[model samples]
Target: MRLTRTILAFALLAAVAPIALAQSQVEITSDVFVMNEAARQAEFEGNVMVVHPNVTVWAPKVVATYGEGGTTDIRTFEASGGNVRLKTADQDATGERAVFTPGDQLLRLTGNVKVTNASGTVDASELVVNLETNVSTFTSTGGGRVTGIFTSQ
Candidate 1:
């Protein structure tokens, strides 16, 4: 079932409004959309898909929490499901859950996370990326080990 895009568009606007990029239009769709203005939160479920100029995400559910300062400021953007997949110009990743904290410029993916790029592929129980420092740390759980394969340019 298709729902109206107007509400979703407005909700997403608040999420991307802070971006100064030239083309920052974001298109999001889902079978369900729940918005709480007072709480400054929006939830999308069932075939949730978000498309931005720099990245695209597909998941069964997504929750966006905005900051108190204003709707334009997003605090946390989270995607969770059996299989959540995200793609960008350079990489593709899949995990059970992905959470991004805009305030700290940090992204965390957990639960059998696997990331692949032109350079290589990495598998771990969790992956944390600090966008501010441009660092990615991957680790495993339950005595498991993180593994990856790389290719020389």
Candidate 2:
């Protein structure tokens, strides 16, 4: 069966308005950055790393899609391959691929997703996180349940 997923752009814009307004200048570096003005898309390949105020993303490739034809108007991001890692504050997470939709204030991590912090680690096949609400949901791709291990001092 073919399933269609739809997300409203404006809704995403509204959901992420707070983050957009409070964001600081973003710095990105990679072996290659491919920008397409006409398509309003940018792709960073080969050890792509993005540094923002409180967030850092590292991946083999990262893609940004924009609504307007400018880099400042990024709507969403996809970090893929090379065990994508995302770090913010005291949290660190790794996955095969991660999709962050600022507009929706949502981050989706897939393929052996693992999240860790000072406490412990949570592992699952898929993880969805809401940046605004600070909530997360994890689902296993197979019949197995999500797992977590916490250590206390």
Candidate 3:
């Protein structure tokens, strides 16, 4: 009886171990640029790309906010005249200005935003994506357009 109980406990532990060890999300690449060490304020420039399980982001400049613990708290990412591309398992988006909130897992893009998926493409002046809910919202300023392309595979 004792051996059987021990085996059951071990099996339960093994099953739960993986779930506990798994991270909420993952990041692919990051580049941080610091102006002054004493200030702890920095700008991340260059091809700052991040690939999560369901989304990706590309930005040129990202302003970082640090906490007293010397760690990052928030980041305001921006890309002007450049492009910000995002992709997931089922959808994709591109835009000019991309703002990301790492702590909240939110992304907002403005200026000629385009989203494409298995169904079609949506074009708007502004776009917002919530990673936690996997939902996206598109808004337009003045004029907006949505184009759909269908190709048989």
Candidate 4:
């Protein structure tokens, strides 16, 4: 009888563990919003704000997609219309438009992108960022400028 009780307890704990681990919470705010229930996606318009974990992003409009099959693909995160603001522990970026591929941890910003960190600030017409590697490439189109300001702190 004691052995059977112990086995049942372990089985119950095992079943609940996965449930707790797989759960996620997302919060979004905007002037107007629409959600697709079947796809588990959302679109926000007019001063959109998205917060997940330690990251916060703000833009004029944003579309968010989630992955299927218990993965963190994120599918696509696109921000347009106005400047995008992304704040994380390591860095911060601002641009006119931004697209992020969460699975790859890649962020592409265009139309006057500017990135600032403890090191300095880089401004360009286009910026591609690899979040995982902390590397960024800046480029210009039609006579753009990149200005860096380094401070010793």
Model 2 Cα lDDT, one tens digit per residue, 3-68: 211133222222322332364556777898665556766677998887777778899998777786
Query: Of the pair 3 and 4, which is ahead by TM-score?
Result: 4
Kindly provide the TM-score of model 2 when superposed on the true structure, using C-alpha atoms: 0.81
List model 1 lDDT by residue over 11-111, tens digit each.
Answer: 56546522212346777789998777668778889999988887888999988888776556678888998789989899999999999887787889999
Pick out the ten consecutive residues of candidate 4 with the lowest summed lDDT. 12-21
lDDT of 3 by residue, 72-126 (tens): 2323334443677767688777888776665576778887888888767778888
Candidate 2 scores a C-alpha RMSD against the true structure in Å of 8.8
lDDT against true structure, model 4? 0.68
> lDDT per prediction?
0.81, 0.75, 0.57, 0.68
Q: What's the TM-score of every candidate structure?
A: 0.86, 0.81, 0.60, 0.69
Error of 4 at 38 (Å): 8.3
**Cα lDDT, model 4, residue 52:** 61
Best by TM-score: 1
What is candidate 2's local distance difference test score? 0.75
Candidate 4 similarity to native, TM-score: 0.69
The stretch of ten residues in a row with the least summed lDDT in candidate 2 is: 1-10
Best by lDDT: 1
Stretches of candidate 3 off by over 4 Å are: 1-32, 35-39, 75-81, 102-105, 145-153
lDDT of 4 at 26: 48
Which scores greater on TM-score, model 1 or model 2? 1
